[model samples]
Target: MADILTLETPRLRLRTWCDEDLAVLAAISADPEVMRHFPAPLDRDEAAAMLRRIRDHFAAHGFGLWALERKDEGQLIGFTGLGWTGFDAHFTPAVEIGWRLARDQWGQGFAREAALAALAAGFERLGFAEIASFTALSNRRSQRVMQAIGMHRDPADDFDHPKLAEGHPLRRHLLYRLRLDEWRERCP
Candidate 1:
C-alpha cells in the first residue's frame, strides 16, 4: 500500500512510517526515560520489529499510530494515533487513542496536540462513536494528556492488564473513554 499521510496539527504532522524514521524511532524506543511507563526499553531489533508491526497495522486498518514529525523542523519526534486495543480487559475490542513522544518534546504540549488531531480523525472523519485510551495507573503524564483531549476516566473501569503477570506493577491500568456526543460537545 502507498503511504498514507492523513492528519496534521498546527505544530505536528502525522504521517506514515518511512525508512528514515527507523533510527530515530529506535532511539526513542530504547530510551529508558521514554519507555519508563512500559515493560522495558526496546533494543534496536525489537524497535525494528515494532516499526514493521506499525506498518502492518496501517496497511490492514488504514490507520494506526502515525509517525509524528515536527513540521517546523521536519524531524520525527514520536507517534500519536488511533489503534485497536487487541487485548481483553473490562473493555475489549475497542479503538484506542494513544501517543508517545521523545523526552525533549514532553513539556511542549506535543502529545496533547497530536492526540486531539487523532481524536478528531476518529470521531469526525471516521465516524467512530467512542474511542478509549488506557495507561499504567502510575503514568500520570499520559493520563493528563488523555484528560486534556476530553476523555473521561472512572476509576470503576480500571483493570489489570491481562498480558502482565499478577504482581507486576504495570499490570494495573486506568481506562478512559470519549463518546462522539461528548467529543462533539467539546469541539463544537
Candidate 2:
C-alpha cells in the first residue's frame, strides 16, 4: 500500500502524518476541552501509541488518516480522515470517517470541509459502499457536522463504545451513515 501524499479541499490539505505532528497531536489530546467527549484525555504515552497505530494503518491499508493542515498556513490544526473501526457492534467492519480540530478551529467549517474530502476518498477512491461517523451521544457539535455532510442518524445503530466502562458519559454513542448511493444522490 503506497502512501497517499495529498488530498485537498477548498481551504484544507489532508496529507500523511509526519514527525512534526507529534506536538500538535499532543496538544489536542491533552486539552480537556478538545477531548471532552472521549473517555479520558490521553497522556503522552497513549498519544504516542495512537500515532504509531495510525502510521501502521497507513502502511497496511495504503489509505488511512490524512493529518489536516490549513491550506494557506500549513498549520497542523488537527486531522480528519476515514479509518477502519470495529469496536462498535452496530457498525462493525465499518470504515468510519472522523475529525478533530483545535478548539480555535471550531465553527469555522474546517471539520466539515476536511471530512467531505475524506468521504470522497472512502466512497470513490477506496470503494467502500458506505462510511459511518459517530460521536458520544452528547456531542451535539459532531452530530450536527454529520448532518451537515448529508449523513442521516440511525439511533437504532447506537452502541456503547467497547473501550468505555459502563455508565461512562462517553460510553453510549450515536451513529450517522452515508452510502455511496446517497452521496451520488445529493450531487446528481
Candidate 3:
C-alpha cells in the first residue's frame, strides 16, 4: 500500500480516505445540520463522487482534504485539510484550508485543532506562502474556526462565490487569510 499522509492531534486523526470510509462520510455529508453551510446535503452518490474527487486531488497535488477520524472512537467524523481554490476570483489559484466535522463532534475544538495541523503542514511541509478560507456570511461557526486558527479576515476581500447563483443566500462569502509569517508568529 502506498504510504498515506496522516496528521495527529490530541483527539483526532487526519488521514487519507479509504473505501471503508464512504458510508460514514456519506452519513456525515447527508446530515442537514452538518451541511447547513453548504448548498445542500449530499446524497450517497454525490458523497461517493466527492470522495473520488478528494482522492484524485491527492493524486494530483500530493495533498488534499484528509478524512477526519476520532482517535478515541476510531470513527470517521468528517474531513479537514488543504485544497486549491477551483473557481475564478481574486483569490483564485490559492491554497485553502477547510474542515467539516460531524455535528456531534462540534464544540470540542476538533475543527480548530485539525486546521492548525493542516496550516502547519501547508507552510512547513508544503511550503505554501499563504492560505485562505471562506464561508457564507451566515456560517459563523466556520468563521470562528478561521479566526481561532490565526486567519484574519479583510472585508474588502469578501466576495460572492462565483459558483453560487446570484441572489442565493449563500453566495455572499467572507474571506480569511493567513500568511506564512503570520502563522509562524502565531504558532511559534
Candidate 4:
C-alpha cells in the first residue's frame, strides 16, 4: 500500500481508506438521504467497486477521498478530500475538493473543517495551482461548504455534467474554483 496520507482538524481526521472502512463506507453510500444528490444510492457491490476506484485513484494520483473519522467518537463518518474531475468541461482535468458525511454528522461543521484541511494540503503540499468543486443545482449544502472554504463561483462557469444524461434533473451543475493566489489571500 502507498504511504497513507492523513490530514487532521479540530474534530475530524481525514485519512486514507482502509479495509475496515468498507462496511461504514458502504453504509454511507447506501443511505438514500446521503446519496440524494448522487445518481442513486449504491448497493454493497457497487460501494465496493467505488472503494476500489478510490484506492486506484490514490495509487495513480497520490491523493483521493480520505475516510472521514470523527476524533471524539473514533468512528468512520464518511469521506472528504481531493480527486480529479474525469469529465470533459471547461474545468476538466482539475483537482476537485469534495465531502460526504453521515447524516447524523451534518450541521456540526465537520465537513467544512475537514475540507479546509484538504484545501490546505492541495495548496501547500501538493502545490496545485487551483482546486475546483461542483455540485448539482439543487445541492445547496455542498455549495455552502464550497463558499465557506473561500471558493468563488462564476455563473458563466456553470455547465451540464457530461456523465449525466442530457435531460437529467441533476445534469446541471455549478462550478466553484479557488486558485493558489486566492487561497493565500484568504488563508494567510
Candidate 5:
C-alpha cells in the first residue's frame, strides 16, 4: 500500500483517511451529541459519502480533513485539518482549519493538539496566507478550540451560512481567522 500523508503532534497523528476509518467516523457522525452543532446526525450512507469526499479532497488538493488518531492508544478519534470552504460566501475560496472528535474524546485537548499541527502545515508547509474557521453561534466548544489555536473572531465577519435555510438555528455563524504573520508571531 502507498504510504499515507501524515502529520504528527505531541499527542496525536493527523493522517489521510483510510477505508478502515469509515465505521468509526460513522459512529461519530451519528452520535447526536457529536452532531449537535451540525444540522443533524448522519446515517451510515451519509457518513460514507463524507468519507469519499474527504478522500477525494486529499487526492485533489494534497490535504483535507485528515483522520485524527490518538498516539497513546492508536485509536481513531475523528478529524482535523484544512479544507477549501467550497461555498460562496464572503469567505469563499478560503481554506479553513477545522476538527471533530468523538463525544467521548471531548475535554482531552486532542482537538487543540491536532489543530495546532494542522495550522503549522497550512502556514509553514502549505504556504497559506491565512486560514479561517467558523461554527454555529452556539458551538462554544469548537469556538474555544479555534481560540486556543490563536484564531481571532471578528463579529462583523459573522455570517448566515447560505447552505442553511433562512432562520435555521445553525445558520448564523461566527468567523475566526489566523493570518500567517499572526501565527508566526504567536509561535516564534
Candidate 6:
C-alpha cells in the first residue's frame, strides 16, 4: 500500500508498519525482558501512541523506524531504524539507530541484519554524520549490537536520559556513536 516501504539486507527486510503489526508491537512492549530497559511497560494507549509517533516520523521525515519483517514468512517481527532522540544539553539533533526484535526472533541475527540496513539509510540517505544508540547499563545485548556495528561508547557524553525521572533505572545510560566517516573507513 505504501510502496511496500522496504529496506533490504542479505537476509531481512525493513518495511513500513502495517495495521497487522499492532498486536506484535503490543506483545513486544508487554514483554518483561523487552520492557526491562524501558521505564515501564506500555499499556495499550501508550503502545498506540508509540505507533503513531513512529508513523508520524516517517510522514514528516521521510524515514523512521521501518517495521522489520521476515522475508521468508512476511510476518511482522519488530522495528529497526533511526529516530530523533529529542534535544538536550548532552544530546541534540541526534539520529539514534535502534532495533527491537520479538522474543521469538532473538538469537537469529535479524536485529543485526535489519539494523545494518537502517545504518546504511542513515548515513547514505539521511546524511547523518554520526548515528548514535543508547541503552541502560543492564542491556548488554543491545550494547553488543552497538559494538558489532562499529560504534564505541563515549563516556564523556553520557548523561541521564531527560525523559526518565530521577530514580528511573534507565535514567543513567551509555551513549555509543558511529560516525559516517568511520563507517566508511571500516567498511571500505
User: Best by lDDT, which number?
Assistant: 3
Clashing residue pairs in candidate 5 are none
lDDT string, candidate 3, 14-87, tens digits: 99999999999899999999989899999999999999999999998888999999899898999999999989
In order, candidate lDDTs are 0.90, 0.86, 0.92, 0.91, 0.91, 0.83
Candidate 4 — what's its lDDT? 0.91
lDDT string for model 2 (1-188, tens) is 33465899989999988887988998888899999998788888888888988888888898877789997998999888878995748568888998888899899999999888888877777888999888999999999999999999877888888888898878888989999999988866
RMSD of each: 1.8, 1.4, 2.0, 1.7, 2.3, 2.5
For model 4, name the residue pairs that clash.
Answer: none
Candidate 4 lDDT by residue in tens digits, 1-188: 23338988889889888888889999988999999999999998998999999999998988889999989989999999999988789778899999988898899999999999999999988889999999999999999999999999999999999999989999999999999999999888
Locate the minimum summed-lDDT window of 10 residues in model 1: 1-10
Off by over 4 Å in 1: 1-4
How high is the lDDT of residue 154 in model 1?
Answer: 94
- Report the C-alpha lDDT of model 6 over 38-144, residue by residue, as the tens digit: 87888777878899999988887788888888888888888998888765847677889888888889989888778878887788777789989999888999999
What TM-score, computed on C-alpha atoms, does each candidate reach? 0.96, 0.95, 0.97, 0.96, 0.97, 0.93
**TM-score, model 4 to reference:** 0.96
**Superposed Cα deviation of residue 102, candidate 1 (Å):** 0.5
Where does model 3 exceed 4 Å of error? 1-4
Q: What is the lDDT, from 0 to 100, of the residue 108 in candidate 5?
A: 89
Where is model 4 more than 4 Å wrong at Cα? 1-4
Q: Report how far off residue 91 is in candidate 5 (Å).
A: 1.8
Q: What is the lDDT, from 0 to 100, of the residue 164 in candidate 5?
A: 98
Clashing residue pairs in candidate 2 are none
Q: State the displacement of the C-alpha of residue 55, model 5, in Å, after optimal TM-score superposition.
A: 0.5
Instruction: Report the C-alpha lDDT of model 5 over 24-106, residue by residue, as the tens digit.
Output: 99999999999999999999999999999998888888889999998889999999988899789987789998888999999
lDDT of predicted model 5: 0.91
